[model samples]
Target: MTTYTPPQRTATLADAPAIAALMRASVLELFPRFYDERQTASAAKHIAAIDLLLIEDGTYFVHEADGEIVACGGWSKRNKTHAGDGDAADDDRPLDPATEPARVRAMFVRGDWTRRGLGRAILESCRLAAKAAGFTSLTLTATMPGVPLYRSFGFTEVERVMMTTPDGVDIPGAIMVKDIDRPDSIGP
Candidate 1:
């Protein structure tokens, strides 16, 4: 069994380029399993860019090993659940923790680090942080290859969303949601 290490710290602006490169590598190498080349490339171009606001909000995290970032992901208390850097609009208003589910955004792993529990580690960090922020539930728009991982983490399919890239390419994804349990009800 692989032992996962906790993320080093919340992401910062300086980490954006590395995170973006990792996202591109992960997408190019993994997305092909579920998407055609055109679809994969289009989706990569649209999605690999990180939202700087997430890092600014201090919710984004990155795990490093051997002096390099191996995994990255985060949760958001904002209305905009998904978007790349250049794609984010002005409607990214904060969400009320009491009324809305926190969003799990921008999960990506280095291609060589796949299936090493790194993704799950970052996910647990997001869940715990979201729960502590008073969110009772979480939601994320999962790329096709990410469905199984989200399912393994107890998220259920809530809806299917088709995102049209700026170049007019439609990428399919699923909205997955999970309810967070109170500390008292969590099982060992």
Candidate 2:
């Protein structure tokens, strides 16, 4: 049997609603295994947000299957590491790729689409894109469910963190980093 892979493409502003829906579904279904009800709800509301700046920068991407977005993720050249932090003046500041690590932000895959290599494919794209933009490393803040995926993709845990949402719920997560310029790093 032939397995079909969805086509990936750069995300546009028009794709925002669909991507947001997908992120919520992914978090709602997968987060329960690692997070309690309150934490999950807080994450669904805050962490699943779309940063329009990524689309504007042409850095975000989505995987389309049957005319729907099944997966979405991207790398960012800006300072924001992840979404839902509320607005900050430095969030849009450009990172100097020569000295700073490019950020891998806002990765989400449909619940049913998990374990099918979509996350790896997205990470590979992020790594290549960041490298092409002159970044030597990449970093991401990974929610519990995403830790294994980032680990398998050559990212090492830098620190564990409790992400506090505006609602004051604490979500357990980790800061992960990968040296993209390393010869041993894996790719898709």
Candidate 3:
């Protein structure tokens, strides 16, 4: 058997399709355990939204290994439309990679990589990229399972967001924020 080694690299646009597929798989697997039936479809839609968001901002990234995208994440400058909008912190509608404080847009890792630190690595990679791009802070709406992960990175809960899927079903989410200037720092 081949030993598993974490892949190292960022995904380019060429990796979008596979990365999106991987994202879908990850979400589909979580549907039953993480959400009601109403929330299941939204998981895939969120994957597409992330795909568009990254495409619009040119921030799609992933770590591939053995010809597959095992980990994926995205980053952007921040949103202009929602700059002052409440509860609309992350999406700027048109999406931008030059917003004042950078934001971690999307992150997903394949199941096989669990417990191998890929999630932390992806978060760090996106954080460092956004910081290098001049963002001082990062924020995201974390799913239940992701809460602890974000917390470990110094992300604090800002609010519990009751979000509705496109189908009018509500899902719980945590609006979280992290200070990039913290001593722990960011990067893979």
Candidate 4:
């Protein structure tokens, strides 16, 4: 069994670039097996999709070994998908602190780090961070290769998300959600 060292704390701003590069490597190398080249290159690149998501909301986190980045993940207080309120202009309400949820925006680990449990560490870290930030549930859009990993973390299928890239390419993804802190139970 491979032993993985867990991170000490949440990621700092300096970790963003390395996190982005890892994301790029993951998408470029792993995504092509499941998604088209266009989707991999346009929508899944590190700087384009991940950098803004991380630097803006600052939900991104990273795990490093010997000063080298190994794993990363993030969650956001805002929902990136449209709420489908019938009116695209429906009164946009700020997220409710009690019931509103945050989302897992991106997650990745270096190729050499696979099977070392880095992914699980990152997922647990994201869940703990989101819970500490007062979020009850977490959501994320997963690519095909990520389905098993997300499922192992107790995420369930929600929907298929169709997204457009900066180059106007359509990227297909699976939507999954998980309640981090509470286990599913019947009402008493």
Candidate 5:
């Protein structure tokens, strides 16, 4: 048996279509466990929206296994914590590192790749990058299905929130935060 190689590099505009597809698949496969059909559809549509800013900023990444994107996620130093395509406005302004925590944004793993350490790897990458950018803490708005993974990364739930889709449906989510004092690891 051979070991699988993890994704190593920043995302680019060329990878947008594949990454969007991965996000949609992930949401459809994973959200059903915690959401109803209508909500799932709304969430899936939202997840499918890819923000090119993250790629342009070199903060987004895609994991390729056999030349296909198996996972995608990223961290952001901007004010927008989370939003999909049409949901977000033109807010790409940088946040004050002196006062604001780095935002962990757009984390998604293909359904076939779940529980395989990909998500954790992407998260560790985010943490290290954020810390290097002078952020002492990090924050993320995690969907209900994503809460467990964030929790395992030592992120504490600050509050329960609802992510509204453009259709006015509210998807349950948690606003979780974590500091960067400890060593970050996804485990071996």
Candidate 6:
């Protein structure tokens, strides 16, 4: 018997709905273990949204199998570090690669696809793309369920943060960073 893996490609505007669905499902199914009910629900409502800027910037990606998007993620050269951050005014500002880290944003994998290297594969693609664009480092705000994956990819927690949802629920998360230009900072 053989297993077939779907190939990843850049996401388009047409993929937004599928990518959004995958992100919401990934959060709702995976976050309960690390967060309370309210936190999980709030995050699913806010953080799991699709950032159209990533798609327009050609930085978002999706892995489709049988015409269904099973996994999605992306890196951004823009100033928006994450969705639902409540700073939409400056979200589209381009980051200076020489002075700022590129952002690894909006990563998601279907619940059944956990531990299958999909997250790592997306991070590797992000790293290479950011490097090619002259960024020496990468940064992300990782929800609790995603901490281990980011750590395994050489990201270090810079600080703990609490994001307040529109409904005023506080969700705890971490800001992680990786100096991708370092020789020892290679992806897992």
Off by over 4 Å in 4: 6-8, 46-48, 52-58, 81-94, 183-188
Q: Which lDDT values do the candidates have, in the order given?
A: 0.83, 0.90, 0.64, 0.66, 0.84, 0.88
lDDT of 4 by residue, 1-188 (tens): 54657564467776667766777787777777777777777745422345354445656677788887877777766655321112224223345547867777667777677756677667777788788888888778776777777777788988987765545677677888888785322221
- In order of appearance, the predictions have TM-scores of 0.90, 0.95, 0.78, 0.79, 0.92, 0.93
Model 6 agreement with the true structure over 54-76: per-residue lDDT tens digits: 99999988888899999899999
Expressed as tens digits, the lDDT of each residue in 1-188 for candidate 5 is 65565766689999988988888988999999999999999988875578888899899878898888998889998988884755446357798877889898899888888877788888888989988999888899889988988988888999999888778888889999998766555443
Where is model 1 poorest over a 10-residue stretch in terms of lDDT?
179-188
* lDDT (tens digit, per residue) of candidate 3 on 66-172: 88888777666646211111235544544333445566666777777655667777777777777777677788877765677678767889999876655566668
List candidate 2 stretches off by more than 4 Å. 183-188
lDDT of 6 at 58: 92
Ranked by lDDT, top first: 2, 6, 5, 1, 4, 3
Report the lDDT tens digits of candidate 1 across residue range 48-161: 877888899999999888778888989898888775644456448888889899999999887778877777767788989999999999989999988888887788898999
Q: Please, what's the RMSD in Å of model 2?
A: 1.6
Off-target runs (Cα >4 Å) in candidate 5 are 1-5, 86-90, 185-188
What C-alpha RMSD separates each model from the true structure? 2.7, 1.6, 4.8, 5.6, 1.9, 2.0
Where does the lowest 10-residue lDDT sum fall in candidate 5? 83-92
**Clashing residue pairs found in predicted model 1:** none
Best-performing candidate as measured by lDDT: 2
Candidate 1 C-alpha error for residue 52, in Å = 0.6
lDDT of 3: 0.64
Task: Please provide, for model 2 over 39-132, each residue's C-alpha lDDT reduced to its tens digit, 9 standing for 90 to 100.
Answer: 9999999999889899999999899999999999999999998866576689889999999999999999998898887888888888889999
